[model samples]
Target: MLPKPIPPQPGQESVWDYPRPPRLERTAKRLRVVFAGTTIAETTQGWRVLETSHPPVYYFPPADILPDVLVATPRTSYCEWKGMAQYHSVRVGQRIAPDAAWSYPRPTPPFAPIAGYVAFYAAAMDACYVDDELVVPQPGGFYGGWITKDIVGPFKGVPGSWGW
Candidate 1:
């Protein structure tokens, strides 16, 4: 059963209001990711995927990420809407966050805008920021959505909300 969505207060957005098949949107907002005391990625050009019951998953362009920071892993996963996905481990200094990032190298047509763009798991990074606000990682390890003050939810990936 789907959980009732939390109503958004002024200036917030409800995840339930997002689309089912998800939509990729280009954003000019400043995006930042930090790990192991280093700012590993930062960009003003990024894409975000919004889906029903989930917060936005932001993707940064390849040019914004630091060189040699991403090491491809053998892991692969499939997204019904985005097609095959590949994983990457991010390393900075002595820290290694395994399978902490992913990309759709050859995305399905509808998601082609995000092809080769990398999305990181907020929980796996020391910090992630949308503009100046720090993000809260979406609940549950499997979903990489980043939650900021503007997004409201009884979001998916919570214990009983998986079936949503």
Candidate 2:
């Protein structure tokens, strides 16, 4: 991506060769969120997918999501850079995706921007949308940002962008 401020180091490599996401000035326009699939399995906060070698992760706002639908799980994972991430389970109809979503209650300093946040696996969702347009999940079990008309790709999980 054009605005990739730092280049990929040795092992990190990079998925950016096109352009970086638009930077914010602390007051960026809010992108509308839309949920699809059965039971509207989605995060309330608008999530941005940062394309990487790993699967696309959907970041959500704590307040934006329906509170009753989620249940805190005892599971936890630690990321040296991102800090300790907490897990939560989602219940939809007869289906229950346990620990399918995660959050950072107390993230490391650098990742504090994502504090009190949650993320979901793209594959776990039944349906999702942004505005009137529908969203298509990126393959390889990825779910970064919602696919919209404004965004262009060579996106990962779409087709040729696999292994991205």
List TM-scores for all candidates, in order.
Answer: 0.98, 0.58
Q: Candidate 1, residue 25: CA error in Å?
A: 0.6
Which is the leading candidate under TM-score?
1
Per-residue lDDT of model 2, residues 13-97, tens digit only = 2444332332111212243332243444333345443543322244666776775667899998886656788887777656677
lDDT of 2 at 54: 29
Identify the candidate with maximal lDDT.
1
Query: Candidate 1: global Cα-lDDT?
Result: 0.95
Which portions of model 2 show Cα errors greater than 4 Å? Answer: 1-15, 18-57, 142-164
